[model samples]
Target: MNIAIVASILTVLVGLFYKGHKNWLMTWLQNFCGSLFVFSGWVKAVDPLGTAYKMEQYFAEFESTFSETWMSFVAPMFPWLSEHAILFSVFMIVFEIVLGLMLLMGAKPKFTSWAFLLLVVFFTFLTGFTYLTGYVPEGVNFFEFGKWGPYVETNMKVTDCGCFGDFLKLKPKISFLKDVFLLFPALWFVFRHKDMHQLFSAGVRNLIVGLSIVGLTVYCMSNYLWDIPSNDFRPFKVGENIGIRKAIEATAASNVPVLAYELRNKETGHVVRVPYTQYLKEFQNYPKEEWDAEQIRGDQTITVVKDANGRASILKFYEEIPAEQLSDYLTSHFELTGDTTVIPIATTKISDFDITDMDGNEKTWEVLQTPNYSFMIVAYKLYFEEGQENRMVYDTTYTYDTIAIEGTDSVYVERKVADVQARQVSQSVYDFDDDYVARYTEVVNPVLEAAQKEGVEAFAITAYGDPAMIEDFRHETQSAYPFYLADDIMLKTIVRSNPGIVLLKNGEIIQKWPYKQLPSYEEIKANWMK
Candidate 1:
């Protein structure tokens, strides 16, 4: 009834095809199980050593899962066994070879059967852990039916899984029913254990058995020696492509048109609208997707204009795309909206900010306004003593304040400052801090100043330093902006160059200014108004 049992029974039946029904099934079981032992043992020999080490790690807590009864006897000695990777690997190869050889020679099925069963039992427990921990679903069923049902259910819910010693990273959800549904050969192995001795004859039959086992052993070794299966990631293992196609067909059957829309800069805050089908054809990369095939149509809008600098302006819609397909439209740009989003307000052309603070808190501040006020965004230094000897140090933080402007929101100013700094640091380090900061002050500060003078509202800067320098660095800057910390990955993603400026209105980006050519106040105002 069980799959393994049925498969085993069928395999035995295949071996007995020429024999009559009387002793046919029994003879078939002996040869089939013998072959399986050789095959499984040889397959496992590919990375016997690595497999053993892995076994130790995953099964370290075996005693915790299983009863302490057997653990006190066999488990106590397990952990130390993994220490010598080379020795373990050698041992595994020898073990599998000997086992396979013995199985092939039909040299006492009594010994081979018990040995094979024990090995399978060990694998079963390991696989069980893998399934239970959600590493992988049940791969090779080693147990009988009544005992395996609950085990399969326990693991079937996992969607992403990997076991079989990481050679197979299985999908989490697997058909336990299919696994438990064994064929007859496996069941016959259990039933005809006493008849296993009859499989090997004295001379020629023994020779055939020896040759069969040796051949399997050689096949197993060849698989490892050449590194063949390592590259094959089981592309069709879970039928991923077929399932995706089916899901896509079902979605298409709904007859719902996918919408592609954009927001246009109609001046001021901007407006959301649908673009003409002709405009969509000219601008969209996915124009081939049917727009009117369904009752409702997908829409996408694009706004075109020129900045004060007379540069071409193209604002397009942003939507989530599949990662695999992202390369198809690699040049497409996107914008983020909603509360608590980090807007890039600068380029990677400036000094890299090593925000010592790692907290993901976005630096947000309201520009403090007094009857008499002075405001400036400072590009300040991280103290030399606080940084490493060979590392290049620079101004590590940037601050933008509204102290000079009346009615300035401190909350917004701080938030903007943090976002800008985070974006700067997000760029991977291009140069040392010392070289970068000097150039930043010489090149980027003036542009920042002009933007500040104009009612540009916000700006950001980046610098580098060790975490120990944060307080001293912050105090020395007397900055107007609140410091926000960001991850190295984030900084690297934004700018690959030096310092840059991204101007924002409300929340939408008005322009991106790299340090290559800083914008003048007149230029800033003109672009701000656009």
Candidate 2:
């Protein structure tokens, strides 16, 4: 593992330099752990929103678990946590970075040691839970082998624990093991807190600690609270071919999980527990008769882990293998009466991305193939403002008006369906948060109009809102372009800007601009779009 390699190198470096000291080993361990903590925390700080989203996912998962049991009293807290996930993320990033600094400088041995141990304990529980979830009988990754389950990790973030943010995606097992390894050093730091050597006098160390806390908190806030992340590590970073990235869903073999299957006969009430396999033939016949394979041990039930109820859980073919190929999937789902394991297939980092038009047409490929320069206006959510700032202004719909022109009564009346812009807006200027309103109206609208006139088509893709609300936003903002739909998470990943602009040609990202830093249409056409 990379962590192990880094630890080894640190050990050699620290040992060689500090060997003259009486307590070199302690120093070495402290340095290694401190370095790791800082790096980990910094990566998360790079895009605090990403961490916020992951926390939301975990909170939702926890909510589900708590709701399932009689101890449902605490379930409400998870929802609250989900709502305030961004705040939690910011604070956690501050703590991790500051704590790591404290440990490295030996700022306060007793305090730092206890904090480190507690942090480790919390992280271990999280990773441990995630790793153990793979064994869930209903979990797609359950003993499926060969490949991780969708539950193993969400393309390293959304579904996964996102410990290192987008910088790295260690397998759940690896993550759990890494935390386990850290337990030893953490315990030692607690028991032998006095042995830790301070790098400077108390005043200097105190000053450093205060500076670090303030600096890191500000840095983290700058990334999410006020602006887009300065660094882009996601696949959608500038210069990536999104078409090719999304295409990996079908072609990437690296993440192809061992084909897992669960089959049951509703008529006989007989449940067949089949071991996971990639081979279609082997998977199909396993229940009826013992199938051939070196991997299968004596007694299929013994080989597979039992469900929570202790009955060997049934395995269904990993769902999401494409509809045409799902002869077995359909068969199992309809013919059998068991919990159909819905392990997400192709839920890789790039696989789960898609965008569709407001009319419900999948326009992902169409957008990818759009000729010449194209602009994507991403608004993870769109609304005028909060509180009394917003009001409905339904714009574009009309009913037919019929009239007799002459004094003589004319029985006949002309009828027609009329369409106009449907919208809503703030009733008063006081209701507007001028900053956001200006971005969409002053910046986004004018730029889009100029781009379209220049033969560069622009489209807005939004999640976190329904079509009606989106229409209200578009009309309210007087947007010149059309809007589409995508997963909110995917939209957030595509660009950190809440309403960011990304330039593309033949599906490759040419450049990106946060709402605050949007370039003039002339500036873009002069540079690359033209």
Candidate 3:
């Protein structure tokens, strides 16, 4: 149907319903839904790629689950969809914002109402699926209620629904519940769309919507195309101190283990689990010989550690026990599991921030503990293909071959051949665009030079990649700072930009700058160094 005809019909329907006292109620509902969507769309628009990553996660989990479930018919398509997640992300963000504006203005109420309902229905399906999947564990069919046994708190494949992007990470259950609640309002709009009130004249409303669409598009594009987010919401954002965070994490991790001791009756081969505290209290008065006669079957301990900064990392520590010495060791150490295993739990989100040099040596702690101010240049990858000229240098080797042949007569003939051997070679030189290298060097070298002049430390960090490529990058760019390796995801979490700069003072992030916004030496000294 033509949009103009739809708009005309919606305008007439809304006008017919406009002569009522319930205008205030409809306006209020419209604004409420409009604001909710606007906020959701705005957060995602600022970091579309972040939403894309979340979409990829959902798609991956869906692909895996679908392959095993009865939904195997559509399993192969999910991976392909995941590959184009960014495109879907952009479409959703724009659709949401446009719908929000239409709702707020009460423009084309009939169309907006139906569109909103359809969108909400789609969201409800996704969230509902996500919530239900949490109960399904590996090796068990999704529909097998008997095999599910009990409600096991298994790890979910897709933890957050990404409904509000990174701004709010709702659990799968909460996301599903939220969508369920939104259904009431969606249905209300479907029936009462005519009661919606227009806030402005038709021309003004159209202009506002047009400008909003253009402005939001430009804003999103600017953030994604050239630099990091204008506002960083990540845990490692500026002003966060890594050293203090680690210290706090360590302090929080110090917890007593909850132990359960298993003892087996050697004669009957019967095993029983006893609480560690009760066992210790009871056995304090019992005979050691009697306890030894009953073999120690298993020992299990559960410990909980919380790091307030972010997610906790669990570390399990185990110890081996000999059957002969189990009783003696348990009495002394008090760390025996049913199977003589000792479990120590410690968790931290910053564990993956571990930095390593190209040689695979850890340098994370050293870098964090440096006394002098440090400058870190993070480039997740040295992203340049071997342009035509250097393609052969990276893949081929030139060699000379000599061959001798006997003629029919008695004479021998020698032949020389210029043989081109096809084998991967370490490319010392790369064919990266000079201007691109120069642009980065111009921004980064001065900062490194300034750090050097002031006796401060500076280094470049990148994800694990070809050592030869890194060496070429260092040489071609004339980088004075040393380069180190870290996980690509870690580098991205540090800063959104490909080649961002982070200024740190004793492991505390003092300032950060995307490539386009890197400050000069004087500017840095004036604004941040003090």
TM-score for all models, in order of appearance: 0.32, 0.71, 0.65
- The list of candidate 1 runs beyond 4 A from truth reads 1-22, 31-50, 63-76, 85-107, 128-194, 197-200, 204-231, 234-530
lDDT of 3 at 301: 30
73-185 per-residue lDDT for model 3 (tens digits): 99899889888887788788888988988987888889999999999998897787677766766677655666643233354566567788767677688889988987888
- Superposed on all Cα atoms, model 1 deviates from the true structure by an RMSD in Å of 22.5
Error of 1 at 360 (Å): 12
**For residues 275-369, could you state the per-residue lDDT of candidate 1 as single tens digits?**
45544665453233322111224322233333454333223313222433322222223242322222222111112223332353333222211
Better of 1 and 2 by TM-score: 2
lDDT of 1 at 212: 55
Better of 1 and 3 by TM-score: 3
Which candidate achieves the best TM-score against the true structure? 2
Q: Candidate 3 at residue 296, lDDT?
A: 31
Candidate 1 least-lDDT 10 residues? 365-374
Residue-by-residue lDDT tens digits, candidate 2, 1-530: 46446656755664566533236667767777887888899999999999998888888777776676676798899999998998999888889888887877777999999999999998997787677775454533323345442332333322467889988887788888999988999999999888776676799999998898899889998987677787887878876666654543343333344434545453454554555644365655544444323222221110112344433222432322333323332343233234332222233455656788777889887888675889999888664543445666656655666777677767556666577665667643323346777888887778888888867888889884556667766777888788899888888888777789999887778998888778789998888765
- The pairs that clash in candidate 3 are 297-338, 298-337, 298-338, 298-339, 299-337, 299-338, 299-339, 313-347, 313-348, 317-344
Runs in model 2 with CA error above 4 Å? 1-22, 137-158, 253-285, 288-348, 384-436
Model 2 worst lDDT window (10 residues):
296-305
What is residue 112's positional error in candidate 3, in angstroms? 1.4
Number of clashes in every candidate structure? 65, 12, 10
